[model samples]
Target: MKTKFLLDPNITFLNHGSFGAVPREVFAVYQQWQRTLENQPVRLLGRKLPSELRAVKSALGSVLNANPENLLLISNVTFGLNLAARSLNLQSGDEILTTTHEYGACLNTLKYLAHKSGARLVQQPVSMPLKSPEDVIEEIWSGVSPKTRLLFLSHITSPTASRFPVAQLCRRANRAGILSIIDGAHAPGQLEIDLAEINADIYMGNCHKWMLSPRGAGFLYAGSAVQAILEPLVVSWGWNVDTPATPEMGLLENLQWTGTYDPSAFLSIPAAIDFQRKHNWINVHMSAQETLSRFLHRFSESFNIPIAYTPEADPYIQMAVLLLPPIKDPEKFQNQLWCKYAIEIPCIEWQEHQFLRVSYQVYNTEADLDRLFSAIEDLMPSFLTTSSHTKSGSL
Candidate 1:
């Protein structure tokens, strides 16, 4: 039996990693929230918003194992990271150490901060053909030094789709007195997240990606110790000369409601959580993982490509990146996949190698993989071949 969602069935949607597709039931609840707000905007935003927000935050906190006080809803991981990067106090000669496998936007965000703070942004090169997660930890940690003030890394890498050993890295950073900021854009619903156990200074995740929430739903978690250092991206009415009775309450008042935007997306988080729980999200995840592993085995064997990360190192989530032959232009190849084949996988160029990333969700099935497989098979001989056959040089 196949699952139903708001996605169009006509297209083979293999790009759930980019922007997740929300289920119809969950979206219906989201729309209902929107309708409720539209009915009486003044009442929803003024009279009842605070209580509603507290309820949503409490539910999200239960799932993340975080204090509702320390958590603040943001538009996305980018928004949260931007706030953290801007709020931190970095001195000149300080080094911001990170891996080269991080998402491009996040790298840019760090670069922007480094440039402003007069600190050097050092990217530690992590070679592929990785044996284990320990290799990743060692490679990334080797760059840390007395000059290193902060360590920023992705829980699951973007381009390579390899899951880094964030917990181990966080422990090492803590021991060395370095602040850790983790970009968990793909982690929340994809994996079991225990914020207390991981214990990073700041962690940001996207609900839209794996949590199957509405777009622009994300949260930033600040450890109690570091909460004082975090400044809202947009300074609004929340900033005050005197501290409020509750720091968490102050954070919600100041940071959560930034200049009157729609809170429906944020309100729908509980519904997304309930939808997944009622449907047994773990079973859905395991089923997707099994199918993805099978498809990956077949696809890699057919194309003579090796798996970039091991199952033990990076277990199957909603997404995985397969290393492919280096292409001259990865963006062009991605465009071809979309325009010619209607296949929506992401082709990323990382470490001079090309990667074809596929994302599987509850709405995806074996037939979807079969379609992608058939498309790649058709493209391999004529388009992906080494020799140029056409004048346009697409093949």
Candidate 2:
């Protein structure tokens, strides 16, 4: 798997949740698409791109168990979220309900929407040591009110690495007449995605994160019922400004052609799907979590840190955020792992606590985890000393 990917072999990459690494085969297709686009710009962009992209969408639809007509190619999830936020046309006193465990960029997007429309953004806390899906559902549902116009949540939260019971919540939102949007940025390739099953009004996912596609590959899925209300972020061929909007125009006509950039990333999606299938990635994904679970136990005992919870839950399938002892400077500790040890993993400060969010991809080997553990052991003393001095108010 390591040889299959194009990541720097010198660095131990434990963070695939942040921009994903592209497989060599998929990258070859990406490069080929770029060359093809450059080879005959007019022929491809003007005539061939739409059909070719439709083929890609059809392929993606198969993977997601969705209709190609419902999906639109996007640069990333952030773009889709911003589009959803602004298009909904929230008014004064409207509330956008979400949990505190959501991604930061999405929180900002909702914040902007709230400020612009005089709406409210209620971040209900889901609390630590998550117990059960039913409990989590009731906890988040408490935030919904009469004025709750839209319900936005992550299918998988970025910071906490939690797989929310989105289907249950989306069903609740649907019954309540609240529009539901899911940011599934870290879902594809890592977990099974069935857009129909999730049943959200709008759903967005990034293929670049876990799907092994080239960076900048993502898709936005809007249910047929809600597609009518969506306003494209950029007005292009999508907008029939002078002419009346046509019923035949779906996501393809409304949001697909927003001034051409590079379609290579989007085009490479089929190849990425092929790569995972050829490698039997479902078993691989499951195996990764099993290995990480075993490693976490050892890591917890060796470091004398209490286990927060078992990552056997869907929320922690291939990725898990492990608890770490309080550090005076989490940034410096993270830098030491990167600058000194050449280990690429995220050390996060969330909710006044420090953490190590490890992403176990197919490329991560036993040696890579060993390298990370060794480096942490070497630097643990210094980190603890810094915490002691900082707490004592002495340098």
Evaluated at residue 298, the lDDT of candidate 2 is 89
Stretches of model 1 off by over 4 angstroms after superposition? 1-3, 242-249, 385-395
For model 2, how does the per-residue alpha-carbon lDDT over 1-395 read when each residue is reduced to its tens digit? Answer: 89988889999999999999999999999999999999999888989988898999999999999999999899999999988788988899999999988988899999999999999999999865565788889999999999999999998888888788899999999999999999999999988899999999999999999998998899999999988788889888868868645558564456877897888999999999999999998899889978888888888788777555533344577888777777768989999999999999999887866778999999999898999999999998878854543432211
Model-by-model lDDT, in order? 0.83, 0.87
What's the TM-score of each model vs. the native?
0.94, 0.96
lDDT of 1 by residue, 1-395 (tens): 23558776677888989988888877998999999999999999989998898898899999999988878888899999999989989988999999888899999999999999999999998877554778878899899988999999999778877677788899899999999999999998988899998999999999998899999899999887788787778876677668643563655446776788888889999988998888898988788877878887887687766676666575457788766654466787778778887778898777656778889888888888898888767765544545222311111
Q: Report the CA-based lDDT of candidate 1 relative to the real structure.
A: 0.83
Poorest stretch of ten by lDDT in candidate 2 = 386-395
RMSD of each: 3.4, 2.9
- Could you tell me how far off, in angstroms, the CA of residue 202 lies in candidate 2 after the best superposition? 0.5
Tell me how far the alpha carbon of residue 324 in candidate 1 is from the true structure, in angstroms, after superposition.
Answer: 1.7
Clashes of each: 0, 1
TM-score of 1: 0.94
